[model samples]
Target: MLQSSVTPHPERDRLMTRTRRIASRLRDLRSAAGTLPDAVVLLDHSQHVRWFNHAAEELLGLKRPRDRGRLMSDLLRHTELAPWWIDGAREPLNDVTAPGHPNRHVTATLLPFGSRQRLLLARDTSHLTRLEQIRRDFVANVSHELRTPLTVIHGYLELLDPEDVPELAPVLDEMRAQSKRMGQIVEDLLTLSRLETQDHVADEHVQMVPLLASLRKEAEALSQGRHTVTLDVVAPIDLLGSPKDLHSAFSNLVSNAVRYTPTGGRIAIRWAPSESDGATFSVQDSGFGIPAAHIARLTERFYRVSSSRSRDSGGTGLGLSIVKHVLNLHQARLAIESEPGKGSTFACVFGPDRLLRGTQAAEAAAAGVPY
Candidate 1:
């Protein structure tokens, strides 16, 4: 390999030496808050613009090197952003002009260079806007999802005053189950948010016996008289991360299997040393498997492969999202394999180091998960 040597310039050296002090003085004089948004621009005495930053290229979708030395008019040629270079107005413009329609919003403003030239500072707000839209859609989806269940529960209650609806007891019970599922979803959402906002790292070691036991118990209860849940291993499994995080992750996977699998179907939880430097906990079930096209998006928040079935099965739709995030916190990862009409397998692959060493082995063996 050949190495190239860089030579230093005296004049450039002096300029670099004084650059910081100059920038500091300029920022102190300006009232701009926080860090100025990063952007790129070009300008000359007349209407020419040279080049700018990578952010500028992305936001404006223009090639800098190719468009350099081009006229500002040719660059923003047909857009309202072109007139933003004219002298006199320093105020920001919030315009989105089209053939006849225009958008309204203000976020960034343009500024002059030295004496005559100027540059436009446009911040990329598209991501933020998309996030807002997702938030809106999620709320609407959740509300729409819960509406039917809520209505059914309400209708059942109204039609059968507990004492009067002795004949409709079964329907009332079903209504109550749906209402409770919705409630569980709401609660899980809160838990997900709280976990994400926390700074919990996967390095936090947690005693796994009780947590896993409780999770298995919860799964069994949810399974009720459906599948016979079985634990493939014993635990006191000292998970090398937050007990809460691991439990939540495993619980979601197991819960989903139990929820979707038909009655009398077998649900198995297996834990064992998996490969070098890792342990694996897998949840297997004889449930309705996911279609090939939908497997990739199964973890997406609120993304349900089977809308009507998701409703019938009473899923809050945030279960996998929670599992995904919780595993991220534990430094573990999820691997899903499924065949439509068969069943699915969700494996929580934890790093071997995250497993308890020495006497902790006994703990893990004793605390094995209940499949």
Candidate 2:
């Protein structure tokens, strides 16, 4: 259709004519990109393909000497690009899968040349598409998990008869506790998801003294009669980051310490700045510590060391997972120290670059990094 009566260019009009010729190469053809020869392909009467690049052969398996003189549709008729060859555009595409390259997606822009010339631009977006799919799937799975417990609680309550089940009080109490645990788990999952997706997080200068005092108070409140915690500040630390985020992070670790420690066991919160050059906060506890075999999976969603024990202790199984995500967001790191019978310590290590001084923090703000 493009190969109509188009006039040939005059010899004196080389620069103007060629630039205009390329500028007019706007055909909405999807069958584009991957120039095997890098030479021009004359699609219609007066318009030629100005150039092609190397990706053509690998992506589409097209070659110049072999494919030249052929109609454009004949060369790309079997591809996802085919629909665009006949029509200028195709309807919005789902993933455009090729036989040899399964689960692949590509994009192209069209250009017009003379009456009917078109240029194809292409890129592989398969990896990005797959990742988005996975994120969606994860979100769905979490939603389903959260809904199950609520459903069970609703069903059980609907069947409850107070007069007939007066002796079932303890069972109902357990049900209520389990429902609360499920709610806690769901909340933690949402929190972890937010932390993972957040574009920016402030890690500000947090002084050690006040943080220790606050943490001690919180630990004492959480420990109650389970264990008495002793506060220990090793290296009087000054950290640069969001104090609130750090507070939550250390709170989670220290709360875990208080919750898991046996009666009369020691729980300690400590801060140290390493010449190895970073800041570290550790919450250590003489609890019924985790076994060597089960440490690595402590951060996985819903993973637990002992299901019954964790349930009895009201563990949501997402505390450490939250810790990991929070630390990673600030470009900080994590370490877990434990012995099966002794105790466990959860520590977060911050790089020296992140531990900026008050002046440096101010300078960074002025310089546009904003800490």
Candidate 3:
């Protein structure tokens, strides 16, 4: 009777074999993940912790069984992480202090996986953060140290008359110009350093109308009647920021346009409303436009699109870098659009929180009328 019941089932055997292979592969994957230096956490659709690796246990203080099925936000308890997690992980949260290891700084990123699951990855960035701080400190110290010497040299050059040394007049003039440029460079560096160290700018009512007018006047003065410079106030909205910092940023954009645009070229400065109720200060110039490749790196310190051209234009190559730092402090962004031979546009965009509308304009909006 037992021998009669013994029958071969090939399909069933193959199915069992395949199941064993799948389980083995999953184990291998878990082992590999556990060995990774970066913290790896698997989450369910609701962002509850499903599983985590050894690194996650050490870095994020996620204990097995105890942390399983717990909400990620509840465990992390970071204000910045909450917004980042809720916003569908649009951007990474940098310099996050690890909950488990408070001394460790981590950059966290989230990515969607199969079956509505997600993966949270965090990498230690403490070393990078320290290195960046060191760089900033070095720049600030060097700039401070050089200021007095530069001032002395510039003053002595100013005292010397070019006419007194007629044979060496050209040399004297060139030396004076270069020394002046160096002094400006040092000032800009100090400004940039200060901006870099600050997390926010002073919240002051920045009157845009007069500021824009002043910027236009400065641009015209810099242009020296060589370019057609105009200002259009499309939106009569002010901003809440440090007036001095805002002026420096706006002036950099306007001066760049004036310096780069050829004679008889058109440079238009416009203050207008942007998307999401934000305000934008844009400088559009019909000058030699930047190449696509060079535009992304324009804000880097001492970055030059054309070294000879920049030097001929008397640019210290730090204007855009300073502008970037100033805008960052003001919670604004710089957007640059350019096409070769056609033109270029540099726009400083500020969020709605920074906008300050006049009382009349606010009343007009409430009455459904354009002011």
Each model's lDDT comes to 0.70, 0.69, 0.88
RMSD of each: 17.5, 16.7, 4.2
Worst window of 10 by summed lDDT in candidate 1: 97-106
Question: How do the residues 73-92 of candidate 3 rate in per-residue lDDT, one tens digit apiece?
Answer: 88876644666776677788
TM-score for each prediction?
0.55, 0.57, 0.91
- Candidate 3 clash pair list: none
Question: What's the number of clashes in each of the models?
Answer: 16, 17, 0
Top candidate when judged by TM-score against the true structure: 3
Which has the greatest lDDT? 3
Q: Residue 288's C-alpha lDDT in candidate 1?
A: 85
Could you tell me which 10 consecutive residues in candidate 3 have the lowest summed lDDT? Answer: 362-371
Candidate 1 vs candidate 2, lDDT winner: 1
Better of 2 and 3 by TM-score: 3
Q: lDDT score, residue 107, model 1?
A: 40
**lDDT digits (tens) for residues 1-371 of candidate 1:** 97769876999989987998899886774424223454456567775766566655655555747877887667665655656645434677543332112332224466778878787666655456557557756765676677677667666565666566688778777777766776677667666666655656645456555555676788889978777887766444556666666777888888889888999898888877676768788989888898889988988888998889888877889999888888877767889999988999999888866788657656555666321
